[model samples]
Target chain A: MTDTWLTSLITDTPQQGYELAITLSRRGVKYTQPDMDTLKKLRPEYANSAEGLTAASHVIAVNFQTVAAANNYWRG
Target chain B: MTDTWLTSLITDTPQQGYELAITLSRRGVKYTQPDMDTLKKLRPEYANSAEGLTAASHVIAVNFQTVAAANNYWRG
Candidate 1:
Protein backbone atom coordinates (compact mmCIF):
# COMPACT_ATOMS: atom_id res chain seq x y z
CA MET A 1 0.00 0.00 0.00
CA THR A 2 2.98 2.29 0.61
CA ASP A 3 4.96 3.86 -2.21
CA THR A 4 8.07 2.96 -0.28
CA TRP A 5 7.20 -0.70 -0.83
CA LEU A 6 7.53 -0.13 -4.52
CA THR A 7 10.90 -1.63 -4.93
CA SER A 8 12.03 -4.77 -6.73
CA LEU A 9 9.44 -7.42 -7.58
CA ILE A 10 12.34 -9.79 -7.84
CA THR A 11 12.02 -12.79 -5.58
CA ASP A 12 14.81 -15.18 -4.64
CA THR A 13 12.81 -18.35 -5.20
CA PRO A 14 9.58 -19.44 -6.85
CA GLN A 15 8.09 -20.39 -3.53
CA GLN A 16 8.83 -16.94 -2.20
CA GLY A 17 7.55 -15.40 -5.39
CA TYR A 18 4.31 -17.38 -5.16
CA GLU A 19 3.81 -16.35 -1.58
CA LEU A 20 4.35 -12.76 -2.64
CA ALA A 21 1.80 -13.14 -5.41
CA ILE A 22 -0.78 -14.36 -2.94
CA THR A 23 0.03 -11.47 -0.64
CA LEU A 24 -0.41 -9.05 -3.52
CA SER A 25 -3.73 -10.61 -4.44
CA ARG A 26 -5.03 -10.55 -0.87
CA ARG A 27 -4.00 -6.95 -0.39
CA GLY A 28 -5.73 -6.04 -3.62
CA VAL A 29 -9.00 -7.27 -2.14
CA LYS A 30 -8.36 -5.32 1.02
CA TYR A 31 -7.68 -2.20 -0.95
CA THR A 32 -10.77 -2.68 -3.08
CA GLN A 33 -12.98 -3.37 -0.08
CA PRO A 34 -11.53 -1.53 2.88
CA ASP A 35 -14.43 -2.31 5.15
CA MET A 36 -13.79 -5.54 6.99
CA ASP A 37 -17.42 -5.84 8.04
CA THR A 38 -18.62 -5.53 4.47
CA LEU A 39 -16.05 -7.98 3.24
CA LYS A 40 -17.15 -10.52 5.84
CA LYS A 41 -20.78 -9.94 5.02
CA LEU A 42 -20.13 -10.50 1.34
CA ARG A 43 -18.01 -13.55 1.96
CA PRO A 44 -20.87 -15.94 2.44
CA GLU A 45 -22.44 -14.99 -0.86
CA TYR A 46 -19.36 -16.07 -2.80
CA ALA A 47 -17.66 -18.47 -0.43
CA ASN A 48 -20.49 -21.00 -0.47
CA SER A 49 -20.98 -21.00 -4.21
CA ALA A 50 -19.11 -23.20 -6.68
CA GLU A 51 -18.98 -20.48 -9.29
CA GLY A 52 -17.48 -18.05 -6.82
CA LEU A 53 -14.77 -20.45 -5.72
CA THR A 54 -13.79 -21.22 -9.31
CA ALA A 55 -13.59 -17.57 -10.11
CA ALA A 56 -11.12 -17.18 -7.29
CA SER A 57 -8.84 -19.84 -8.74
CA HIS A 58 -8.92 -18.14 -12.09
CA VAL A 59 -7.57 -14.97 -10.54
CA ILE A 60 -4.86 -16.83 -8.71
CA ALA A 61 -3.65 -18.51 -11.89
CA VAL A 62 -3.49 -15.15 -13.58
CA ASN A 63 -1.53 -13.72 -10.69
CA PHE A 64 0.82 -16.64 -10.66
CA GLN A 65 1.43 -16.15 -14.37
CA THR A 66 2.48 -12.57 -13.74
CA VAL A 67 4.68 -13.50 -10.83
CA ALA A 68 6.22 -16.26 -12.86
CA ALA A 69 6.94 -13.84 -15.67
CA ALA A 70 8.53 -11.40 -13.26
CA ASN A 71 10.67 -14.22 -11.97
CA ASN A 72 11.29 -15.41 -15.52
CA TYR A 73 9.51 -18.57 -14.50
CA TRP A 74 12.42 -19.00 -12.12
CA ARG A 75 14.49 -20.40 -14.96
CA GLY A 76 17.52 -18.61 -13.66
CA MET B 1 -10.82 -26.57 -4.57
CA THR B 2 -13.31 -29.02 -5.90
CA ASP B 3 -13.03 -30.30 -9.45
CA THR B 4 -16.77 -29.99 -9.72
CA TRP B 5 -16.47 -26.23 -9.47
CA LEU B 6 -14.87 -26.10 -12.88
CA THR B 7 -17.02 -24.20 -15.34
CA SER B 8 -16.95 -21.37 -17.85
CA LEU B 9 -14.64 -18.49 -16.98
CA ILE B 10 -17.00 -16.06 -18.62
CA THR B 11 -18.41 -13.27 -16.46
CA ASP B 12 -21.23 -10.86 -17.19
CA THR B 13 -19.76 -7.67 -15.81
CA PRO B 14 -16.38 -6.23 -15.03
CA GLN B 15 -17.29 -5.83 -11.38
CA GLN B 16 -18.33 -9.45 -11.17
CA GLY B 17 -15.23 -10.52 -13.02
CA TYR B 18 -13.02 -8.58 -10.63
CA GLU B 19 -14.73 -10.11 -7.65
CA LEU B 20 -14.23 -13.54 -9.19
CA ALA B 21 -10.54 -12.83 -9.75
CA ILE B 22 -10.09 -11.95 -6.11
CA THR B 23 -11.86 -15.11 -5.12
CA LEU B 24 -9.61 -17.20 -7.38
CA SER B 25 -6.53 -15.60 -5.92
CA ARG B 26 -7.71 -16.26 -2.38
CA ARG B 27 -8.62 -19.85 -3.11
CA GLY B 28 -5.16 -20.36 -4.56
CA VAL B 29 -3.60 -19.44 -1.25
CA LYS B 30 -5.94 -21.73 0.59
CA TYR B 31 -5.12 -24.55 -1.78
CA THR B 32 -1.42 -23.96 -1.37
CA GLN B 33 -1.49 -23.59 2.39
CA PRO B 34 -4.34 -25.60 3.77
CA ASP B 35 -3.23 -25.17 7.35
CA MET B 36 -4.99 -22.09 8.69
CA ASP B 37 -2.74 -21.94 11.75
CA THR B 38 0.38 -21.88 9.61
CA LEU B 39 -1.14 -19.31 7.33
CA LYS B 40 -2.02 -17.13 10.33
CA LYS B 41 1.46 -17.56 11.76
CA LEU B 42 3.00 -16.39 8.51
CA ARG B 43 0.64 -13.46 8.08
CA PRO B 44 2.51 -10.96 10.24
CA GLU B 45 5.75 -11.52 8.39
CA TYR B 46 4.35 -10.12 5.16
CA ALA B 47 1.23 -8.23 6.18
CA ASN B 48 3.16 -5.57 8.11
CA SER B 49 6.01 -5.11 5.66
CA ALA B 50 5.91 -2.44 2.96
CA GLU B 51 7.59 -4.61 0.34
CA GLY B 52 5.10 -7.34 1.04
CA LEU B 53 2.15 -5.04 0.55
CA THR B 54 3.44 -3.73 -2.76
CA ALA B 55 4.17 -7.21 -3.93
CA ALA B 56 0.54 -7.91 -3.25
CA SER B 57 -0.57 -5.05 -5.51
CA HIS B 58 1.68 -6.27 -8.26
CA VAL B 59 -0.03 -9.63 -8.22
CA ILE B 60 -3.43 -8.04 -8.15
CA ALA B 61 -2.71 -6.02 -11.25
CA VAL B 62 -1.59 -9.15 -13.00
CA ASN B 63 -4.77 -10.91 -12.00
CA PHE B 64 -6.88 -8.00 -13.19
CA GLN B 65 -5.23 -8.21 -16.58
CA THR B 66 -6.31 -11.80 -16.96
CA VAL B 67 -9.81 -11.17 -15.77
CA ALA B 68 -10.12 -8.22 -18.07
CA ALA B 69 -9.05 -10.37 -20.97
CA ALA B 70 -11.63 -12.97 -20.12
CA ASN B 71 -14.31 -10.32 -19.96
CA ASN B 72 -12.98 -8.73 -23.14
CA TYR B 73 -12.53 -5.68 -20.95
CA TRP B 74 -16.33 -5.52 -21.00
CA ARG B 75 -16.31 -3.73 -24.31
CA GLY B 76 -19.68 -5.11 -25.19
Candidate 2:
Protein backbone atom coordinates (compact mmCIF):
# COMPACT_ATOMS: atom_id res chain seq x y z
CA MET A 1 0.00 0.00 0.00
CA THR A 2 1.13 3.54 -0.67
CA ASP A 3 2.29 5.26 2.45
CA THR A 4 -0.31 7.82 3.45
CA TRP A 5 1.59 10.80 4.77
CA LEU A 6 1.09 14.57 4.67
CA THR A 7 2.97 17.68 5.72
CA SER A 8 1.03 20.79 4.89
CA LEU A 9 -0.04 23.52 7.24
CA ILE A 10 -3.65 24.22 6.42
CA THR A 11 -5.36 27.23 7.93
CA ASP A 12 -8.82 28.01 6.68
CA THR A 13 -12.45 28.00 7.59
CA PRO A 14 -13.92 25.19 9.64
CA GLN A 15 -15.55 24.17 6.41
CA GLN A 16 -12.20 23.86 4.73
CA GLY A 17 -10.79 21.91 7.63
CA TYR A 18 -13.80 19.64 7.57
CA GLU A 19 -13.47 19.14 3.86
CA LEU A 20 -9.80 18.31 4.17
CA ALA A 21 -10.55 15.95 6.99
CA ILE A 22 -13.10 14.18 4.85
CA THR A 23 -10.67 13.92 1.98
CA LEU A 24 -8.01 12.55 4.31
CA SER A 25 -10.40 9.94 5.64
CA ARG A 26 -11.30 8.78 2.16
CA ARG A 27 -7.59 8.47 1.34
CA GLY A 28 -6.89 6.55 4.53
CA VAL A 29 -5.34 9.65 6.03
CA LYS A 30 -6.41 10.94 9.40
CA TYR A 31 -6.48 14.24 11.26
CA THR A 32 -4.37 14.48 14.38
CA GLN A 33 -5.25 17.26 16.78
CA PRO A 34 -8.45 17.34 18.72
CA ASP A 35 -9.71 20.41 20.62
CA MET A 36 -7.07 22.65 22.23
CA ASP A 37 -7.65 21.67 25.82
CA THR A 38 -7.44 18.00 25.02
CA LEU A 39 -4.15 18.49 23.21
CA LYS A 40 -2.70 20.14 26.27
CA LYS A 41 -3.95 17.33 28.43
CA LEU A 42 -2.30 14.75 26.20
CA ARG A 43 1.15 16.31 25.95
CA PRO A 44 1.70 17.26 29.52
CA GLU A 45 5.45 17.78 29.11
CA TYR A 46 5.04 19.81 25.96
CA ALA A 47 1.91 21.14 27.60
CA ASN A 48 4.14 22.89 30.15
CA SER A 49 6.96 23.83 27.77
CA ALA A 50 7.44 26.96 25.70
CA GLU A 51 7.01 25.01 22.49
CA GLY A 52 3.69 23.75 23.72
CA LEU A 53 2.61 27.25 24.65
CA THR A 54 3.75 28.61 21.34
CA ALA A 55 2.03 25.79 19.50
CA ALA A 56 -1.18 26.69 21.28
CA SER A 57 -0.99 30.33 20.27
CA HIS A 58 -0.07 29.79 16.64
CA VAL A 59 -2.02 26.58 16.11
CA ILE A 60 1.05 24.75 14.73
CA ALA A 61 -0.04 21.50 16.14
CA VAL A 62 -0.16 18.97 13.33
CA ASN A 63 2.36 16.17 12.82
CA PHE A 64 3.53 14.65 9.56
CA GLN A 65 3.06 11.01 8.61
CA THR A 66 6.62 10.37 7.60
CA VAL A 67 10.01 12.08 7.69
CA ALA A 68 10.36 11.87 3.94
CA ALA A 69 6.99 13.47 3.45
CA ALA A 70 7.76 16.13 6.00
CA ASN A 71 11.17 16.71 4.45
CA ASN A 72 9.69 16.99 1.01
CA TYR A 73 7.13 19.51 2.12
CA TRP A 74 9.65 21.39 4.19
CA ARG A 75 12.16 21.35 1.37
CA GLY A 76 9.66 22.39 -1.23
CA MET B 1 2.16 -2.70 8.65
CA THR B 2 1.33 -0.27 11.39
CA ASP B 3 0.62 3.24 10.14
CA THR B 4 2.93 6.03 11.18
CA TRP B 5 1.46 9.51 11.57
CA LEU B 6 1.91 12.48 13.84
CA THR B 7 -0.05 15.57 14.91
CA SER B 8 1.96 17.53 17.41
CA LEU B 9 3.46 21.01 17.25
CA ILE B 10 7.11 20.76 18.17
CA THR B 11 9.01 23.92 19.10
CA ASP B 12 12.47 23.60 20.53
CA THR B 13 16.10 23.98 19.59
CA PRO B 14 17.41 22.96 16.22
CA GLN B 15 18.93 20.06 18.10
CA GLN B 16 15.54 18.93 19.26
CA GLY B 17 14.12 19.40 15.81
CA TYR B 18 16.96 17.42 14.32
CA GLU B 19 16.63 14.73 16.91
CA LEU B 20 12.96 14.41 16.26
CA ALA B 21 13.60 14.34 12.54
CA ILE B 22 16.08 11.54 13.01
CA THR B 23 13.64 9.61 15.14
CA LEU B 24 10.94 10.10 12.58
CA SER B 25 13.25 8.99 9.81
CA ARG B 26 14.06 5.77 11.63
CA ARG B 27 10.36 5.18 12.02
CA GLY B 28 9.73 6.06 8.36
CA VAL B 29 8.05 9.32 9.31
CA LYS B 30 8.83 12.19 6.99
CA TYR B 31 9.02 15.89 7.62
CA THR B 32 7.20 18.36 5.41
CA GLN B 33 7.70 22.10 4.92
CA PRO B 34 11.03 23.03 3.50
CA ASP B 35 12.66 26.35 4.19
CA MET B 36 10.34 29.34 4.31
CA ASP B 37 11.24 30.59 0.84
CA THR B 38 11.07 27.16 -0.72
CA LEU B 39 7.77 26.38 0.94
CA LYS B 40 6.45 29.60 -0.48
CA LYS B 41 7.78 28.59 -3.87
CA LEU B 42 6.05 25.20 -3.76
CA ARG B 43 2.70 26.24 -2.37
CA PRO B 44 2.24 29.47 -4.25
CA GLU B 45 -1.49 29.34 -3.68
CA TYR B 46 -1.04 29.12 0.05
CA ALA B 47 1.93 31.42 -0.31
CA ASN B 48 -0.37 34.17 -1.52
CA SER B 49 -3.26 33.16 0.67
CA ALA B 50 -3.77 34.58 4.16
CA GLU B 51 -3.54 31.10 5.63
CA GLY B 52 -0.21 30.57 3.94
CA LEU B 53 1.03 33.87 5.25
CA THR B 54 -0.13 32.97 8.71
CA ALA B 55 1.48 29.51 8.53
CA ALA B 56 4.75 31.12 7.54
CA SER B 57 4.76 33.38 10.54
CA HIS B 58 3.74 30.68 13.01
CA VAL B 59 5.70 27.73 11.53
CA ILE B 60 2.66 25.47 11.66
CA ALA B 61 3.30 23.60 8.46
CA VAL B 62 3.49 19.96 9.41
CA ASN B 63 1.01 17.24 8.33
CA PHE B 64 -0.33 14.32 10.32
CA GLN B 65 0.50 10.71 9.39
CA THR B 66 -2.74 9.04 10.50
CA VAL B 67 -6.02 10.27 11.89
CA ALA B 68 -6.10 7.69 14.66
CA ALA B 69 -2.60 8.62 15.82
CA ALA B 70 -3.34 12.29 15.64
CA ASN B 71 -6.62 11.78 17.42
CA ASN B 72 -4.92 9.77 20.14
CA TYR B 73 -2.30 12.43 20.80
CA TRP B 74 -4.79 15.27 20.70
CA ARG B 75 -7.13 13.38 22.97
CA GLY B 76 -4.43 12.40 25.40
Candidate 3:
Protein backbone atom coordinates (compact mmCIF):
# COMPACT_ATOMS: atom_id res chain seq x y z
CA MET A 1 0.00 0.00 0.00
CA THR A 2 2.95 2.28 0.02
CA ASP A 3 3.92 4.49 -2.91
CA THR A 4 7.37 3.06 -2.51
CA TRP A 5 6.24 -0.43 -3.51
CA LEU A 6 7.77 0.20 -6.91
CA THR A 7 10.79 2.35 -7.57
CA SER A 8 11.54 1.09 -11.05
CA LEU A 9 10.66 -1.79 -13.33
CA ILE A 10 14.17 -2.02 -14.68
CA THR A 11 15.52 -5.38 -13.67
CA ASP A 12 18.82 -7.07 -14.39
CA THR A 13 17.19 -10.30 -15.49
CA PRO A 14 13.92 -11.47 -16.97
CA GLN A 15 13.26 -13.51 -13.86
CA GLN A 16 13.68 -10.38 -11.80
CA GLY A 17 11.41 -8.47 -14.11
CA TYR A 18 8.75 -11.14 -13.86
CA GLU A 19 8.99 -11.12 -10.09
CA LEU A 20 8.67 -7.36 -10.11
CA ALA A 21 5.58 -7.68 -12.27
CA ILE A 22 4.00 -9.97 -9.69
CA THR A 23 4.90 -7.60 -6.89
CA LEU A 24 3.41 -4.73 -8.82
CA SER A 25 0.19 -6.64 -9.27
CA ARG A 26 -0.01 -7.56 -5.58
CA ARG A 27 0.88 -4.10 -4.37
CA GLY A 28 -1.63 -2.63 -6.75
CA VAL A 29 -4.39 -4.59 -5.08
CA LYS A 30 -3.22 -3.54 -1.64
CA TYR A 31 -3.09 0.10 -2.67
CA THR A 32 -6.52 0.05 -4.27
CA GLN A 33 -8.22 -1.70 -1.38
CA PRO A 34 -6.41 -0.82 1.82
CA ASP A 35 -9.26 -2.03 3.91
CA MET A 36 -8.33 -5.55 4.97
CA ASP A 37 -11.76 -6.08 6.49
CA THR A 38 -13.56 -5.70 3.21
CA LEU A 39 -11.12 -7.91 1.40
CA LYS A 40 -11.48 -10.65 3.98
CA LYS A 41 -15.27 -10.44 4.00
CA LEU A 42 -15.65 -10.94 0.30
CA ARG A 43 -13.11 -13.73 0.02
CA PRO A 44 -15.46 -16.60 0.67
CA GLU A 45 -17.97 -15.69 -2.01
CA TYR A 46 -15.45 -15.57 -4.86
CA ALA A 47 -13.23 -18.29 -3.39
CA ASN A 48 -16.13 -20.73 -3.41
CA SER A 49 -17.25 -20.02 -6.93
CA ALA A 50 -15.53 -21.06 -10.17
CA GLU A 51 -16.83 -18.07 -12.10
CA GLY A 52 -15.48 -15.64 -9.54
CA LEU A 53 -12.03 -17.23 -9.65
CA THR A 54 -11.96 -17.22 -13.45
CA ALA A 55 -12.99 -13.59 -13.48
CA ALA A 56 -10.09 -12.76 -11.19
CA SER A 57 -7.66 -14.55 -13.46
CA HIS A 58 -9.05 -12.71 -16.47
CA VAL A 59 -8.32 -9.34 -14.92
CA ILE A 60 -4.80 -10.41 -14.02
CA ALA A 61 -4.20 -11.44 -17.62
CA VAL A 62 -5.36 -8.05 -18.83
CA ASN A 63 -2.98 -6.28 -16.50
CA PHE A 64 -0.14 -8.62 -17.34
CA GLN A 65 -0.67 -7.92 -21.01
CA THR A 66 -0.15 -4.24 -20.34
CA VAL A 67 2.98 -4.90 -18.36
CA ALA A 68 4.37 -7.25 -21.00
CA ALA A 69 3.70 -4.66 -23.69
CA ALA A 70 5.39 -2.00 -21.64
CA ASN A 71 8.34 -4.28 -21.18
CA ASN A 72 8.24 -4.92 -24.91
CA TYR A 73 7.44 -8.53 -24.24
CA TRP A 74 10.65 -8.69 -22.21
CA ARG A 75 12.52 -9.11 -25.46
CA GLY A 76 16.20 -8.43 -25.51
CA MET B 1 0.85 -20.42 -20.26
CA THR B 2 -1.36 -23.42 -19.91
CA ASP B 3 -5.11 -23.09 -19.51
CA THR B 4 -4.74 -24.88 -16.21
CA TRP B 5 -2.70 -22.12 -14.58
CA LEU B 6 -5.72 -21.16 -12.58
CA THR B 7 -8.43 -23.60 -11.71
CA SER B 8 -9.80 -21.59 -8.79
CA LEU B 9 -9.12 -18.47 -6.75
CA ILE B 10 -10.34 -19.96 -3.53
CA THR B 11 -7.61 -20.02 -0.95
CA ASP B 12 -7.56 -21.06 2.69
CA THR B 13 -5.77 -17.93 3.73
CA PRO B 14 -5.26 -14.36 2.63
CA GLN B 15 -1.62 -15.08 1.99
CA GLN B 16 -2.60 -17.89 -0.35
CA GLY B 17 -5.14 -15.69 -2.05
CA TYR B 18 -2.59 -12.96 -2.62
CA GLU B 19 -0.09 -15.46 -4.00
CA LEU B 20 -2.74 -16.83 -6.31
CA ALA B 21 -3.43 -13.30 -7.51
CA ILE B 22 0.22 -12.82 -8.34
CA THR B 23 0.36 -16.13 -10.18
CA LEU B 24 -2.73 -15.22 -12.12
CA SER B 25 -1.15 -11.95 -13.17
CA ARG B 26 2.10 -13.58 -14.18
CA ARG B 27 0.42 -16.40 -16.05
CA GLY B 28 -1.75 -13.85 -17.80
CA VAL B 29 1.29 -12.16 -19.27
CA LYS B 30 2.76 -15.48 -20.40
CA TYR B 31 -0.47 -16.51 -22.04
CA THR B 32 -0.75 -13.19 -23.84
CA GLN B 33 2.90 -12.81 -24.77
CA PRO B 34 4.39 -16.22 -25.28
CA ASP B 35 7.38 -14.97 -27.19
CA MET B 36 10.32 -14.77 -24.83
CA ASP B 37 12.53 -13.27 -27.52
CA THR B 38 10.15 -10.35 -27.95
CA LEU B 39 9.85 -9.82 -24.20
CA LYS B 40 13.62 -9.79 -23.78
CA LYS B 41 14.07 -7.37 -26.65
CA LEU B 42 11.58 -4.88 -25.26
CA ARG B 43 12.91 -5.10 -21.70
CA PRO B 44 15.57 -2.43 -22.02
CA GLU B 45 13.22 0.28 -23.20
CA TYR B 46 10.75 0.14 -20.34
CA ALA B 47 13.12 -1.43 -17.85
CA ASN B 48 15.47 1.52 -18.05
CA SER B 49 12.81 4.21 -18.11
CA ALA B 50 10.98 5.51 -15.05
CA GLU B 51 7.80 6.25 -16.93
CA GLY B 52 7.63 2.71 -18.27
CA LEU B 53 8.02 1.22 -14.81
CA THR B 54 5.44 3.53 -13.29
CA ALA B 55 3.03 2.76 -16.07
CA ALA B 56 3.44 -0.93 -15.35
CA SER B 57 2.57 -0.37 -11.72
CA HIS B 58 -0.44 1.72 -12.66
CA VAL B 59 -1.80 -1.07 -14.81
CA ILE B 60 -1.29 -3.55 -11.97
CA ALA B 61 -3.24 -1.34 -9.58
CA VAL B 62 -6.09 -1.14 -12.03
CA ASN B 63 -6.21 -4.90 -12.39
CA PHE B 64 -5.93 -5.46 -8.66
CA GLN B 65 -8.80 -3.09 -8.08
CA THR B 66 -10.93 -5.16 -10.38
CA VAL B 67 -9.96 -8.36 -8.60
CA ALA B 68 -10.61 -6.82 -5.21
CA ALA B 69 -14.06 -5.72 -6.26
CA ALA B 70 -14.82 -9.12 -7.66
CA ASN B 71 -13.81 -10.69 -4.36
CA ASN B 72 -15.92 -8.15 -2.49
CA TYR B 73 -12.75 -6.63 -1.09
CA TRP B 74 -12.07 -10.05 0.47
CA ARG B 75 -14.14 -8.88 3.42
CA GLY B 76 -15.27 -11.58 5.76
Candidate 4:
Protein backbone atom coordinates (compact mmCIF):
# COMPACT_ATOMS: atom_id res chain seq x y z
CA MET A 1 0.00 0.00 0.00
CA THR A 2 2.70 2.44 0.98
CA ASP A 3 4.86 1.33 -1.90
CA THR A 4 2.02 1.91 -4.27
CA TRP A 5 1.44 5.33 -2.80
CA LEU A 6 5.11 6.27 -3.01
CA THR A 7 5.35 4.87 -6.51
CA SER A 8 2.34 6.93 -7.49
CA LEU A 9 4.07 9.99 -6.09
CA ILE A 10 6.86 9.34 -8.58
CA THR A 11 5.19 7.47 -11.43
CA ASP A 12 1.71 8.88 -10.92
CA THR A 13 0.43 5.34 -11.23
CA PRO A 14 -0.10 2.41 -9.02
CA GLN A 15 2.25 -0.55 -9.37
CA GLN A 16 2.12 -4.10 -8.16
CA GLY A 17 3.53 -4.73 -4.70
CA TYR A 18 6.65 -6.59 -5.69
CA GLU A 19 7.28 -4.35 -8.63
CA LEU A 20 7.02 -1.21 -6.50
CA ALA A 21 9.29 -2.70 -3.87
CA ILE A 22 11.83 -3.55 -6.50
CA THR A 23 11.53 -0.14 -8.01
CA LEU A 24 12.07 1.57 -4.67
CA SER A 25 15.00 -0.70 -3.94
CA ARG A 26 16.58 -0.14 -7.30
CA ARG A 27 16.21 3.59 -6.91
CA GLY A 28 17.91 3.40 -3.50
CA VAL A 29 15.00 5.10 -1.77
CA LYS A 30 14.92 5.54 1.99
CA TYR A 31 12.26 3.80 3.98
CA THR A 32 10.15 5.65 6.47
CA GLN A 33 8.46 3.71 9.23
CA PRO A 34 5.26 3.56 7.20
CA ASP A 35 7.25 2.36 4.26
CA MET A 36 8.83 -0.33 6.36
CA ASP A 37 5.53 -1.37 7.82
CA THR A 38 3.98 -1.51 4.41
CA LEU A 39 6.92 -3.43 3.03
CA LYS A 40 6.79 -5.90 5.87
CA LYS A 41 3.12 -6.35 5.24
CA LEU A 42 3.49 -6.70 1.51
CA ARG A 43 6.79 -8.54 1.41
CA PRO A 44 8.56 -9.14 4.65
CA GLU A 45 11.49 -10.77 2.92
CA TYR A 46 12.19 -7.63 1.00
CA ALA A 47 11.66 -5.28 3.95
CA ASN A 48 15.12 -5.79 5.37
CA SER A 49 16.82 -7.18 2.32
CA ALA A 50 20.24 -5.83 1.42
CA GLU A 51 18.72 -4.00 -1.48
CA GLY A 52 16.00 -2.48 0.71
CA LEU A 53 18.49 -1.13 3.23
CA THR A 54 20.58 0.36 0.50
CA ALA A 55 17.52 1.91 -1.05
CA ALA A 56 16.43 3.29 2.30
CA SER A 57 19.73 5.01 2.84
CA HIS A 58 19.69 6.35 -0.64
CA VAL A 59 16.18 7.66 -0.16
CA ILE A 60 17.20 9.41 3.03
CA ALA A 61 20.23 10.97 1.43
CA VAL A 62 18.43 12.00 -1.68
CA ASN A 63 14.67 12.31 -1.31
CA PHE A 64 14.22 12.81 2.42
CA GLN A 65 17.11 15.22 2.43
CA THR A 66 15.32 17.30 -0.12
CA VAL A 67 12.07 17.17 1.78
CA ALA A 68 13.84 18.20 4.94
CA ALA A 69 15.53 21.01 3.16
CA ALA A 70 12.24 22.16 1.77
CA ASN A 71 10.82 22.13 5.27
CA ASN A 72 13.74 24.16 6.52
CA TYR A 73 13.17 26.66 3.79
CA TRP A 74 9.65 27.15 5.09
CA ARG A 75 10.59 27.25 8.79
CA GLY A 76 13.02 30.01 8.11
CA MET B 1 15.74 25.44 -8.24
CA THR B 2 13.11 23.80 -6.02
CA ASP B 3 10.79 22.78 -8.82
CA THR B 4 13.61 21.16 -10.73
CA TRP B 5 14.70 19.32 -7.62
CA LEU B 6 11.15 18.13 -6.92
CA THR B 7 10.73 17.10 -10.52
CA SER B 8 13.96 15.22 -10.37
CA LEU B 9 12.63 13.46 -7.29
CA ILE B 10 9.67 12.28 -9.31
CA THR B 11 11.06 12.01 -12.81
CA ASP B 12 14.65 11.30 -11.93
CA THR B 13 15.48 13.77 -14.62
CA PRO B 14 16.08 17.48 -14.70
CA GLN B 15 13.57 19.46 -16.70
CA GLN B 16 13.33 22.97 -17.94
CA GLY B 17 12.18 25.38 -15.28
CA TYR B 18 9.12 26.38 -17.22
CA GLU B 19 8.23 22.84 -18.16
CA LEU B 20 8.55 21.64 -14.60
CA ALA B 21 6.46 24.53 -13.34
CA ILE B 22 3.72 23.57 -15.75
CA THR B 23 3.97 19.93 -14.85
CA LEU B 24 3.70 20.55 -11.12
CA SER B 25 0.77 22.80 -11.77
CA ARG B 26 -1.05 20.12 -13.69
CA ARG B 27 -0.26 17.55 -11.05
CA GLY B 28 -1.73 19.75 -8.31
CA VAL B 29 1.28 19.58 -6.04
CA LYS B 30 1.58 21.63 -2.89
CA TYR B 31 4.39 24.09 -2.52
CA THR B 32 6.75 24.45 0.33
CA GLN B 33 8.60 27.74 0.77
CA PRO B 34 11.46 26.36 -1.26
CA ASP B 35 9.09 25.34 -4.00
CA MET B 36 7.53 28.75 -3.98
CA ASP B 37 10.92 30.42 -4.04
CA THR B 38 12.04 28.21 -6.85
CA LEU B 39 8.83 28.72 -8.75
CA LYS B 40 9.13 32.45 -8.38
CA LYS B 41 12.65 32.27 -9.67
CA LEU B 42 11.67 30.08 -12.59
CA ARG B 43 8.30 31.57 -13.42
CA PRO B 44 6.73 34.09 -11.13
CA GLU B 45 3.67 34.21 -13.32
CA TYR B 46 2.86 30.66 -12.45
CA ALA B 47 3.62 30.80 -8.74
CA ASN B 48 0.30 32.10 -7.56
CA SER B 49 -1.81 31.19 -10.52
CA ALA B 50 -4.99 29.31 -9.81
CA GLU B 51 -3.39 26.18 -11.12
CA GLY B 52 -0.28 26.61 -9.02
CA LEU B 53 -2.16 27.08 -5.77
CA THR B 54 -4.33 24.11 -6.57
CA ALA B 55 -1.30 22.02 -7.30
CA ALA B 56 0.35 23.15 -4.13
CA SER B 57 -2.65 22.19 -2.07
CA HIS B 58 -2.85 18.87 -3.80
CA VAL B 59 0.79 18.21 -3.18
CA ILE B 60 0.39 18.98 0.48
CA ALA B 61 -2.67 16.81 0.78
CA VAL B 62 -1.23 13.86 -1.01
CA ASN B 63 2.53 14.03 -0.64
CA PHE B 64 3.25 16.07 2.47
CA GLN B 65 0.55 14.25 4.33
CA THR B 66 2.19 10.96 3.59
CA VAL B 67 5.55 12.22 4.67
CA ALA B 68 4.06 13.51 7.90
CA ALA B 69 2.29 10.25 8.53
CA ALA B 70 5.50 8.41 7.93
CA ASN B 71 7.23 10.68 10.39
CA ASN B 72 4.59 10.04 12.98
CA TYR B 73 4.98 6.35 12.53
CA TRP B 74 8.65 6.64 13.21
CA ARG B 75 8.16 8.89 16.19
CA GLY B 76 5.94 6.29 17.74
Q: Compared with the true structure, what per-residue lDDT tens digits does model 3 show for residues A1-76?
A: 3355656656554344444555665566667888899878976564443333334445555644455445544444
Regions more than 4 Å wrong, model 2? A1-76, B1-5, B29-76
Question: lDDT of each model, Cα atoms only?
Answer: 0.60, 0.36, 0.52, 0.34
- Per-candidate TM equals 0.47, 0.20, 0.41, 0.24
lDDT of 4 by residue, A29-67 (tens): 334344666544754343323232222323322343244
Off by over 4 Å in 1: A1-29, A32-76, B1-6
Judge candidate 3 at residue A4 and give its lDDT.
Answer: 56
Model 4, B1-76: lDDT tens digits are 2223241322222233234334333232222122444333534433546764554444333333333332442343
Q: What is each candidate's DockQ, to 2 decimals?
A: 0.08, 0.07, 0.07, 0.02
Better of 2 and 3 by lDDT: 3
> What's the residue-level lDDT of A6 in candidate 2?
48
- The DockQ-derived docking category for candidate 3 is incorrect
Docking class of 1: incorrect
Error of 3 at A46 (Å): 1.5
**Can you write out model 3's per-residue Cα lDDT over B3-71, one digit (the tens) per residue?**
334333345555565565555544544543456665465556555778656655544555454344444
Model 2: how far residue A2 lies from native, Å:
16
Q: Where's the lowest-lDDT run of ten residues in candidate 2 chain A?
A: A67-76
Better of 2 and 3 by TM-score: 3
Instruction: Report the TM-score of candidate 4, chain B only.
Output: 0.34
Best of the two (3, 4) by lDDT = 3
Write model 1 residue lDDT over B7-74, tens digit each, in one string.
Answer: 75577764565556666765667789988999889776545543443344445566666766665555
